[model samples]
Target: MASVPSLSASIQQRVADALGADPLLRRSDRADFQANGVLGLAKRNKANPREVAAQVVEALPTGDDDGLIAAIEVSGPGFLNITVSDAAITRTLAARAADDRLGVPLKADPGTTVVDYAQPNVAKEMHVGHLRSSVIGDAITKILEFEGEKVIRRHHIGDWGTQFGMLVQYLIEHPHELDHEAGETAAGEESMSRLDRVYKASRKLFDADEDFKTRSRKRVVDLQAGDPETLALWQRFVDESKIYFYSVYDKLDIAIRDEDIVGESGYNDMLIETCTLLEESGVAVRSNGALCVFFDDIKGKDGEPVPLIVQKADGGFGYAATDLSAIRNRTADLHADTLLYVVDARQALHFKMVFEAARRIGWLTDEVTVKHLPFGTVLGKDGKPLKTREGVSTKLEDLLDEAVQRAAVVIRAKNEELSEEVVAARAAEVGIGAIKYADLSTSLGRDYVFDLDRMVSLTGDTSVYLQYAYARIRSILRKAGDAKPAAHPELPLAPAERALGLLLDEFGNTLAGVAETYEPHKLASYLYSVASALATFYEQCPVLKADTPETVENRLFLADLTGRTLRQGMTLLGIRTPEQL
Candidate 1:
């Protein structure tokens, strides 16, 4: 299929090139599209509005079969309510059906994008807090890649800091602490279990024994100083943590590679240099023995300036220092045109200051743009942050497992004869997709409630609904023996056929917008609208049992295209569509 230029875009360009002004075109509620730019253009040129609209209308290309614009009426001042011909819609869709891209165009000038997301801490279980970043970031990456953008995934896990000193020192004391049986080490869950036990024991000893605390603090200094022994011990913790991270990612069905697992410690070598550069450049000042970057507009509760501390007074580097160094590596070394930090919304101010500080140091300049794609917390049904009865954070694995379990029940009811293995397999797809769809259905900046009941339901905006819609279409096509889908643009179309065709024609335009804005929710909403229109079409227009063979084939063509569109869209969002119920 070839890339199809949208009807609105064609008209807008025609109007703009003719009048040499912005077209300001919008999809009309009552008409196909409305061009409201003539009113402004007329005022600017000191001409009559209706007369200017007439000139713009005359500029439109005229044709009977291939002409994009069918009717253009200039009414009420200078508003041009335009309608595209049904023939044109069918013709464009025919082109789309012939291409693998489904008529979506690759970016003319694609650039590198580094996405930082799915951060988890060392020697700890992943919680629901990390869910949004992983899901949203995966979708964004997929969407960007589909658009031909060079996407780099950075896990940015929490695999560094003074805490490692305690774990390492404890491991040193108990040399076989992290060592498991030959069979056990192969399992990620078993690896996590060993780490959790060691972590708890280390923390308990570090807190209770005075001498151990001194040894642990000294280990931190040794680790930072690059002592081979301490550094080697720290590496063990990092490697072990990745095992757990990979397991959780696998369960979620996200493909995370080992090479992309760059944590905070990845910037360790450059931290000191980063601080030195800031101080030398005078972007940072030594205040109370700490290197700090101050902003006039940023203040504390006492009306005093709150500076970003690059280094503590105790001669230790802070997160800001590590992040500044990361900017240099990502922008200068990676040659990334865009840097995206998919972090928590609470870190907005920290990123603002960090990015500003990076700009001051000339690391992030005109050639590169950075954005902290902040996301809100996932709340429970009670409208509070999700947590267990003991107030501990809900484990991400547990949440995912529950979703799959609930989906199995739904699948079982739909098909009682399904084997346990098949039911479980389909359940994972539906359950995982439900969680992802619900998260993406809402705007990235808004907090969303996590309700498995709503997410796994067969109706509404859930992914299950979309999945079933695709499956139903597949079923219809399978049942139509020897009835191949064939397009007939010359045949008169019912209103339902016309409506579905118009919506299908907008796929390229809709995806282009979503990819450009880095907003997956927009794509989700667009897909939902397409699915809804498809439902209406199916109900009103019979495919296999139509009165005539040509009409049946034409309706089947519409159904076939709709299924392909849904599958393509959902795949971009990291969701799977099963062929059966």
Candidate 2:
């Protein structure tokens, strides 16, 4: 089956044809869809509202044969409440079940999209703040790819700066500090520990010893000038940091490729050319011997226009220079139609200035669009930033480990029959799924509390709920054993079945909306609604113990489809649904 038109789409098209304009149809609580266009159309034409509504009802294709709608009633002054045929709902879902992609059509004209996300600073521990970018960006990447759009992932990690000078200089002085003699390749934990020790010692010396500080500053120049030894030591920091980065990413179930790890250093060669081009084009001007782009709306506390400093008077580049260069590369080199930056809300102004500068430079044209999907913070239950008792930023590894540990306890208590090995495996899935779901479920622009108890709860709007809902359906389908799920459109649907079927039919449309808006929360909400609908259906209708054999089979078919749809939606959100969980 080709892509099936939504019931609302079919009705809207029919109503649009009759009205000779858009019908402005929307789903209603009282009916499958309500047409509010009649009142506006009537008031505009100076015609009686009831008469126009009645005329639309007359033109409606609610006939018995080849008709999607079952009833079209003229309600109130000029409103039309429409109910689609029960057969149509089941038929559309059956079409969805038969084909893959959940009946969603790949975009006809997909464009190249370059997504900048999952940024982690080198030689530093990844804190809870990095979670949103990686999880949200991964979901967006999957969703866009599913929509047939060409997507390029950019880690945009921070792997260069003056900090490396301190770290590398200290490592060179203490030759054995970075020695991996224990083994040729050090573990991620060992690498991080070594880096942490070296960084602390180096910082102490730099603060106390003026001579060491001077040498460290000179090492920064040597590193930038491609001094072989200095560059070699700098690479070790990056390499060790990547080892830790990869380990943490693996635990989170997110894939981070080496090639995609384009850090701050990647655009170094382009910085000079980028600044010169901006200066020659007058996009940037020298203010006190420093390149800057000033915005009228952006003013400092001194009532002066705050400029985005591209380069400092000290002959050093800033983040804006690298970002502007990235925009040029993503456009002029990658030929991306859409440039998406999934950064934190705190960096909103930085990106705003950078994008505006890019637009002024003609690097981002009318055909090319750039958007910053700035997300809100993740607060603790205390409504403050999530932190350890020591008042330090919580490490990413500890957070993930604790989630899994808590999930294991929940799993064992819920089902004592499971073996330890099974509990351990399911715990990881449930825990990670819970964490990712909690993040994705909240609207992107709002801050949400991180509560482990609520997240792993078997009840409420948690991933565990969805996971169990799917597991229940899977269990029922398995009990049916040899009997396969086969849709019977001829059979009548119960009210509960009708509700679930209608909601299920909206899955493809819901997914399309999520992909278009770059909002994973919407998809999360949609899955929750489907799960809720399934609960109501399970309560009102019996699958294995229906009144008749055909009734049982039909209900079984519905259960199976619900399971598959739930699995697909969760997978898109980067959550895994275990069959046995």
Candidate 3:
């Protein structure tokens, strides 16, 4: 593999030689790059288009720059419409094949990023909504890590607040609810189901009975005061929730570290001090006897200004208080240069106010970047927010389980030779990949359908398609046996090979954009393009049955590179591409 010049660099050199000075280069449908600035250069120099273009062409490097510039023509209105050769495309792809990192460079100035995601409230059921946050956040984490940036994951689970009080009070009344000998319960199912039942019963009683509500309220105060018994009960609720959350994450094939989970309760101590910092700075003022920050742009239907309440009139800290404190800790204490909140789109207003308040007090300055990656809802087939047939929000675990089961059916039908264990493992990958890919393939701000059939289908823009493409490439390589993949520089290029090479060279450039935009969907789109191009190439070019050994080796090399690129790209998107899938 020979060294390959970057597309942008190559274009810039051609333009400079042809038109002189800085020339704007962009991808176009008409040509590789339409140098519209050529006319401007002629205007400035008071010369004709042909003469200006001739000088620039003469200045273009000769010997080594042969195939890179196929033709540089002076088009309508003095536009320098340029077209590149297949040789240039192949050389660039060869360069990418030489690098382990796929020719992608790390950011020049990477910073520590603290991301808040996967926040399901403690002692409650996690719905499909939580899936969006976890899936999106996980993809972002992978992409950031690929760019060689430091990423700190914070689950920000809702493990504290008045709800814990109700749960604790109920547990105190019935101490045997969450109590069961280790072996008495089923490995994973029975334990979680029992906890779920107790939680529902406690919630019903707490809501209907006035006396029970009062006791629950007092339990909150006791729990906050570090009452030993109440604290122990609180711990049980958290432990049970973790078991359930872990099961869901496992089914999704995503790893969530135990130590990284820091819920709202974790920021309890800093809440008061955070409020004090805001008040002292005059960033927060007392509104209706409650500490709040009002924004001129945020208004209700009645046209009254909306305020983000830091502290309620009853002296209780709400969600805002905890998040503001978290910002302070992440920036001042953790030394994070980038703060990312991957939450539901519904909480956009809360984050907007929190970020504004954080900036006002200097907790977040111009030097620190804060972003709220707000994602839209997951709708059912009816285009409404996803819910069970009975109208209740579906549990995250149940949804994932069903998706995996559906995937198993597809896998069994397609590949009968796969062992039971492989089928099971592949089912989890395909199911979870379907869900995560569905969320990531689209822009983060839009609603997407949750359809298992569509996700597991072998065709279309699904993970199954990409995985299958990868598996096919691997199979081809295996069939090639000991015949090594050696690039044949002398071989002529086919149309499909040229297209694949051009797309392959863009891997690094696309990743650079993804890192800058914080958009994994862009990377997803790029991977889909690579797979699509490979499919076309496979149909056009013969690998094992080629006319010559050299052509066979070159085609095999191309297939090997495509497989590696697909596998690596899918891994970065948090999707597994099984070699035999």
Say which candidate scores most in lDDT. 2
Candidate 3 on 1-581: residue-level lDDT in tens? Answer: 22345776688776775555777776666766676676677888798866777667666653346767776766676666676765666666677778887777777688999988898877677789889889889988888888889999999988888878888889889888887686674334555776788889999998899999999999999988889999888988888878777877877777889888999889988888988877788999988889999899999999999999999888898788999999888988889999998888888888999899888888889999999998888999899999998999988888888888988999999989989999999998888888888889988899998888898899999999999999999899889977878777667778788677767777777777887787889999999999999999999998888898888888887888888888888888889888887
Point to the candidate with the largest TM-score: 2
Tens digit of lDDT per residue, candidate 1, span 268-352?
Answer: 9999999999999999999999999999999999999999999999999899998999899999899999999999899999999
Model 3 scores a C-alpha lDDT of 0.83
The residue-level lDDT of candidate 3 at 197 comes to 82
**Of the candidates numbered 1 and 3, which has the greater TM-score value?**
1
lDDT of 3 at 48: 88
Indicate the residue-level lDDT of 15 in model 3. Answer: 77
Q: What is candidate 2's lDDT per residue for 287-333, written digit by digit as tens?
A: 99999999999998999999999999998999999999999889999
Lowest lDDT block of 10, candidate 1: 61-70
lDDT of each: 0.89, 0.90, 0.83
lDDT of candidate 3 at residue 255, scale 0 to 100: 83
In candidate 1, how many Å is residue 575 off? 1.0
